[model samples]
Target: MALDSNENSDKSIHKFESMLKTDDVYFFDAEDFEDIIHHYLNNGKVSLGKKAIQFGLQQHPHSVELKLLHVEVLVFEDKFEEAGKWLDELQNIDSHNEEIYVQRANIQSKLDNHKKAVELLQQALELTDDSFDIHSLLGMEYLFMDDYEKAKLSFMRCVEFDDRDYASLYNVVYCFEFMEDYDGAIRYLNDYLERNPYCEVAWHQLGKMYFSKQMYQEALAAFDFAIISDDSFLGAYFEKGKVLEKLGKYREAIDCYETTIEIDDPTSHAFLRIGKCHEELGNDDLAKYYFYNTVHEDPLLDKGWLAITEFYFRKKQYKKALHYINKAINIDGENARYWKKCAEIYSALKNFDEADFAYKQTVDLGNFELDTWKNWVTVLQKTADFNTAEQVLLQAIEFYPEEAILYYQLTLVYLASDKPHEARKKLKSSMELNAEMVTHFKTDLMKYNRFSWITAIFADDKKASA
Candidate 1:
């Protein structure tokens, strides 16, 4: 009868430890040494693994497996040149060994030679009946090459061989997601579930796939199954909460989020979700409490900070909003959204100079949204920085060459700068692009309406159109 692997490993490990304490020699066969070394390496006890390898080779110097284990340890320690030399020596002794090819592939992969690694793995696959590990390695190589289709196939083969291979299953889903093959992913997961029905990880993954497709009910059912399989699965509860929120079940969503907190530590993300749910339910006090909890739990969470800033902004609490937004900016100064928010809050308080600086920061950080440019220009005009306003509008026009509003705004800036020629030129361009938008700035244009040149241009355009 075959020895139980756990029992055998336990006896070998105990014997090895006992021998280490004394100066006595232990008689461990090549396989026992392999398991012992594997145990140390897998558990991240590298020094002990090296010791075990040295002792193992001393006992069985000609054992190819022991030599390979030494090579593995060398690779782990990043002694690539040494490992390669050792592998070459082993290959000469046992060229038919699949492990030689696999270890060579590992070295190639570490060096980022993914294509060469794939070739080596293919050779290993040819030599070995157990292709599961080789397929997993092949999938990773294909992923490194960004060949999602091949990666998906490789990982799927791993899943077929062992349905419990959640890591390979995750890679399969990731490939499908990268390719945006949601239906195919759903189909594959559904088939996987039929064989391994109670796999919480697979069910969690299925829920996310369905959620991506906006199939909320299907997502909810999958998440519920995940929770039923493993009630301690925090991810399922969090996702279930999100699904409930999408379905407008605020109370139920809160319950799910609270369940995650019960299962594990309260995450900033969970607190944020609960806050959003309370906000949806019109429980403003409860929302504010959770929003505070979110930032307190994780001060670095930008989303949590933004939520609090927006909450106060909605209540017209401009000072409070400004305070929280400034805090967010202090945490992530490069965040364009936070800078934009700061600019808007400053503009609301009529702090035009501060607002202008914030707006500049927002643009500098690469936020080229139309409203950002428009709002920044408006702030410049408010501060009577006609020179800078004209410059700002001109820059905005480049990004929005066809946008009539920018041309109209530029016309105003030019008129304010006492450059009627430039103003008329931009006014005509604006009319040409969108004459109807002229109504939006009619009140401002009325100030310059008394100018004969402006009146004449409008008259000529109207006559030409008629």
Candidate 2:
């Protein structure tokens, strides 16, 4: 309908221009001026609109519609004060006019006084015989205020007047999602589907709500319905693929994702998911192919790089994994997980210095995973960097105070450094935290020939308790 309207507007504009060119005086009525002015305004030709308004008033001096268009032009030009004065005059001239109230509300909305805008629009709603535009404006004002429920109601009212208001239908769904009312969204969308069974967006949104609740079969069916409504619905295909993957149907999921690529241009998300589905199906070569395609499609897609890196890691190809992970870090240097992966690969290759640096980057980037810290300490110990190991464990203990493992590692570091006093103190702390963890210290204590220290500490604790 919008396209048809635009086409008619273009034809009218061309006819009017032709008349002006052929005749010395191209006489037109107020309605002709309104159409020309509206065309120029909608097309963002403000100067043309202004010229039409001037010509319009000369032909029909008492045209309230022409006057309203002039005020709208003023508002569009950010001449809010001038527009307000015009609106006041219009209101006085026709006290029962709804357009005047609507224009006033638009100015108030622009001024960031949404409450005033809503009040004025509500007044217009009461006066106007047709409340469609009023309800739409009220919905927008409520949306600006983040009162999504009221906005939803207003938009629903607009929808009631015209079920073809696709924008309002979308907003109603958005409000339901924002409120986390999944059941409400399902009920609303079901009702919407009953009225407009061919609405692809409504079916897609219904599928999403079902997917969120882990109703995989229902989600799949909804997505199928959406695709039936619109065979070229790319989002429905993508979401349906996710549901298939969730249901452990990797091959079917890949087919759906591939269909999205065929329907539209390749998206990074679709490629990544296809790669993951292939990986799950144990088709490593295909997985690697899709993973490479994923990064090739979107160079900045961090997950694509991570997927390729994990592929190599799973295949025991540590060098390739390290290479891809380094590429990931270079692309997104602030990502802690990439740094942690780099640390892990370096540690696997026994490159302790590089491992230490990568671990430092991981911690600095706030990864703080127990494995990152534990392996960092292990690398330090492997490299005989006892002092740094002790320092790292101390920091780890602050974050993992309840974890007996960090304290146990600290105790071993102290003993390795010949700090018997610190060792005994740490060993006592670890035992208090978890007696089961004391077993880990036994093997290391025997290696250091400090079994007597462990026995003595326990005996001392027993004597104190007695």
Candidate 3:
């Protein structure tokens, strides 16, 4: 009975061994094992790969390939400390082995020691006469190190060894771009296109390099090819739109921006460009609607608020402009432009106290523009805070000593505050800058000089505080 059982077990083992070897066909259990590994790798299931590797070892004990793959799986799992143990075991068994060195390099690359990875790959290069993969890996390591010159050299070697590799050609082109060799980048990419006509990244990068060099038409053509190759290439479409914008093709630019917005809603720049394109095409309502949509999509985006604020400002809608600009300030209170816009709107609305506060906020944010200084003086003077107004005017004069408006403004503040003696000192400064200051001031203020709206408040001291 024991012998019969032993014979049956032996037959079953023989059948299993036969099944493991592929007989003139690729169908085998080993193929299933590789599929599992690939699935684990693609899904980032490092633990499962590790467990699978252990189970696979029981079936195929002498597979050095599997052992090597297990190390890769450990590294992918971010179990670098554990991967080190496998490396030590591999080193002891196969010291000076080229493949072991490459595996170690891959492990080191995962740990971000790219320089060490490159040095290890160089050693592997000495062992193999025709090693395109070793060179490609070296290029990838150098790219990670930001050594674009070395990366380009290594990637060029990979192309020479295996020009069929599209990624290798693309890597060399990217290195040229990173090194700022626009001509070299274009030349290599063009050569690559002649060999592999469907390289999408090369097409996109060629467009980007040409755009950077101010070759707009060539950029458009390259982007055309890139978008044709991958219809969902949002970045390529965006570049195409920007090139069209620079070439004064507003309608085509709008189409490209709209296309990109359809694919990529998270891009704040796309919405902004589309809104500007609509504005350029004399579509104010469409522009305003898209600007509002951008704000709805990303409430935290400063550009969205700026766009909406500018929309209202352009329409002379001071209150709406103030609302959006104030929302912008609330989102990011330190922004100088929002504070300035709010101050301008409040001044236009005759909200003098709020205008003073807004101008002071702009000043606090270090905005020292000439007009910003002028606005500050106007708001302070309107508030009957002539003391602060004089201080602000002097600061403006310090920066713009020859500005006729600063001296004239100081004179206005003094004359308005019932201090003609202080007004006389400012009058001399005004006279030095302007032979016609009094005429211009009187002429400009004549429209609003009907001080019924302005003087009603200054008629009482507590009026300003109110």
Predicted structure with the largest TM-score when compared to the true one:
1
RMSD of 1: 3.9
**What is the lDDT, from 0 to 100, of the residue 176 in candidate 1?**
94
Q: Give the CA lDDT, 0 to 100, for residue 412 in model 3.
A: 75
Please report the TM-score between candidate 3 and the true structure: 0.61
Across 1-466, the per-residue lDDT of candidate 3 in tens digits comes to 0011233334433443354464522222543454555555556666655655665666676666567777777666688788778778877877766777787788889878888998898898888786878888888898889888998998898887876676887788778877789999898889878987876777998999899899999999999999888999998999999999898888999899889878766577787788878888889988887788788888888888988988888789988898889888878999988888888889889999998998899989999999999988878877789989989988888899999889888877766776666766776777677856555675433434454533332345346558
> Stretches of candidate 2 above 4 Å error?
1-7, 16-25, 40-62, 73-77, 313-319, 325-466
Q: On a 0 to 100 scale, what is the lDDT of residue 35 in model 2?
A: 83
Kindly list the per-residue Cα lDDT of model 1 for residues 1-466, writing each as its tens digit: 0112455687899899999999999899999988888888877788888888899999999999889889887776778899999999998998999989988898899999999999999999999898888898899999999999999999999988998889999999999999999999999999989989999999999999999999999999999999999999999999999999999999999999999999889999999999999998999999999999999999989889999999999998999999999999898999999999999999989999999999999999999999999999999999999888888888888898999999999999999888999888889999999988987887788788878866765576679889
- Model 3 clash count equals 0
- Give, for candidate 1, the lowest lDDT window spanning 10 residues: 1-10
| Model 2 C-alpha lDDT per residue in residues 113-159, reported as the tens digit of each score | 99999999988887977888789889989999999999999999989
Report the Cα lDDT for residue 9, model 1.
Answer: 86
Ranking by TM-score: 1, 2, 3
Off by over 4 Å in 3: 1-32, 110-112, 129-133, 157-171, 198-200, 227-235, 259-270, 298-302, 313-322, 325-466
Evaluate model 2: give its TM-score. Answer: 0.73
Candidates sorted on lDDT, descending? 1, 2, 3
Look at candidate 1 and tell me the lDDT of residue 20. Answer: 95
TM agreement with the true structure for every prediction: 0.86, 0.73, 0.61
